[model samples]
Target: MIHLVQIIQRFVRIPTGILAIMIYTLIVYLIYLAFTKYIPMLIHQTFDMIQSVIDFYEHQPKDADPVLQYIHNYIERNDFFEQLQNGASIALGYLQDIGKMAVAFAMSFILSFFFMIEKQKTILFSRLFLKSEFSWFFQDLYYFADKFVNTFGLVLEAQFIIALLNTLLTTIALAAFGFHQLLSLAIMIFILSLIPVAGVIISCIPLSFIAYSQGGIRDVVYILMTILVVHLIESYVLNPKLMSSKTDLPIFYTFVVLLVSERFFGVWGLIVGIPIFTFFLDVLKVKKIPNHSPREIDIL
Candidate 1:
């Protein structure tokens, strides 16, 4: 965001910190809009698709194809429509949590804004510990913290690019297949793509349902395949190259970090797991901190 702030600075002269926070607030606002709007669309599409299935099951001829009949019979026996209703209700319930997340995200940016504006004071005050008796401990702490920030910042930059690419590819694929509400879908994909492995799966489920409503099972299959291909490109081609250059970790290590972090820290872990692991590596002197980094703590 600070990089973006600098870019904007060329065209307009404004306080950098203020501009950065303005950008952050704008992003959060967009995310809030997505949570409010797209979620309802997802549920509505899902409900419509499920209702169509129920209608077909009800109105099908007595001599309908046996396999198809058997499938619809299974759906009925499982109380699938009722389950979908309950699921929709539960999904709606999550809107409260989404509100909380948006508030927290906004608050984090506010804190960051203050920190940016007070960077000199923050650094000087934080550096006072260098002369403390437990300076060794503080030094170690700063070492790890610097590594984490630098690596995390780089990964975030790369992730934004990856998310943008993923959104464009997914949108084009959906558009080619003649999907509807594509603007909403593209926004959701771009947001979810920031979340690593879990993001792909989370976005896929509702998207698949929406695709089903648009063009039945075949459309769902295409949507799944498109997501899979995009994810493969992100995980293998993009992430490995970017992360390996920045953190010196193999893709295997990255996956392990993600899995372990996800187990312990849930969703937040997927976002930070690689950075934390790289911090440990930097502490152990197994990974070298990149010379060009966004953090000032390293030299301090």
Candidate 2:
């Protein structure tokens, strides 16, 4: 197994780094397009929802509550449509910034490509710059890098598997619920699922809102329940099994790390916290060894 991994890493190191950069670029581009194209439609949908509520209240009986009546009148008096238009115009400027970001990413890809090709030269240059007093520091850094790569790579593999499964299940559920735009929603969910606990919560809001818009409060309740169940499964079953298969940490430890990291660093902490914790555990040689009798041979 070690030999196979070494061989695979030897062949894939450069390609993997390049591929990672490309994937990041693609994700950024997709996000830019989604924001530029879909956000206006979403805003329009929200406006329609507001308008629908206002219209409903306008046709209500004369005995309607004074508070509700005041709210409805206030909505009618506001220039919501104009405000939405202005918001869309502001959003277009962000799209221009996204274009600049894409260009920067392209330059980064070029640099990474050259770095991959001249990896040996880069290592030589680093060594030449280091003083003899810092030799031990460099050795420790190398050790940390090796552990990080192996541990983090496993975590990524497990996460990819989880994300794919989550996407498939979410797509099926959306289709069953007769939701429109399954493809885009599924893609969004898959990408968000790569984040961690907060990702599931963040995805639920838009999904529930869409359900409410399409099929009322009951549909929203159903969608929320479905998401809750899926998240439970991911948290209790999939994450523990997959992460433990790669690293020795227990499920409880994983959750604790996620919570603490999120408290400190917010969303990005959730994404990287587990792998970072796993790398440290490995570096510290922490393991869970089973306690057994000396005659614990299998009877079968």
Candidate 3:
């Protein structure tokens, strides 16, 4: 936040607080747009994708390929569409819960904006207590408290950037292949890219299915190759550079954290499990995430 303020200071003269407010307001607006616009579109696209697949299965020619014929027969025999309807209803309820979370996030950003604006005053206010007879107690409390928040924030920011970049690159590859439903697929990619190794594998199943539906086995091979390349770049290039080295746990640990966190915190645990773990590590003074990372510094 301070770095952003400094960058803005060079362009036009403005009070630090006002600039901070402007930046944060822009962030809040983006968050609002994401929840109100992009997320709803993603949800609708998901439903459409499912419905279209069901329609394709139901309407296939009697003399269709053997595999597709078998798949269609299985769906018909199992009443798959009815099962999907039930799942869709449950997913809708989850989306509504997400809407509630958006409200909570907005409230948090608003409160944090006030804190950013009054940061200097808060520091001075704290210094008075820090210099008192109980200085050591207050100092340790304040230091650990601030470090915990920043550690979580750093990990979350890194993950978001990595996901966004992965989505963009993969979407470009799909577009180059003239894939259908690119917008919907891009949104899905972004959501799944939040997970680590397993996300790419899971995303591949749907992507390959869609690719095959569009252009047979040839397209499936092409998309699989694309996914493989993206996965390699994400794992080897993005993770090491963008992610904090401090939280650079092994693949086994990442999966374990995801599994345990998912069981305890539901879906969100997958997204936040790493960040929470990094925070605890910070509390132990185990490792550190640099304050001015190049990735974010280059952004503004």
TM match of model 3 to true structure:
0.84
Of the pair 2 and 3, which is ahead by TM-score? 3
The candidate, 1 or 3, that scores higher on lDDT is 3
Global lDDT of model 2? 0.67
Candidate 2 deviation (Cα RMSD): 9.8
lDDT of 1 by residue, 111-227 (tens): 877776776677789878987899999988876666666766676777778888899999999989987667667777887887666689889987976675556678889999999
Question: Runs in model 1 with CA error above 4 Å?
Answer: 9-71, 85-99, 131-134, 187-192, 195-213, 216-221, 235-237, 244-259, 267-275, 281-292, 295-299
RMSD of each: 4.5, 9.8, 4.1
Query: Which of the two candidates, 1 or 2, achieves a greater lDDT against the reference?
Result: 1
Q: Order the candidates by TM-score, highest first — what do you get?
A: 3, 1, 2
Best by lDDT: 3
Misplaced by over 4 Å in model 3 are 1-3, 10-13, 25-44, 132-137, 285-300
Can you give the TM-score per candidate against the true fold? 0.70, 0.54, 0.84
State the weakest 10-residue window (summed lDDT) of model 3. 291-300
Pairing residues by index, what is the TM-score of model 2?
A: 0.54
- Per model, how many backbone clashes are there? 0, 0, 0
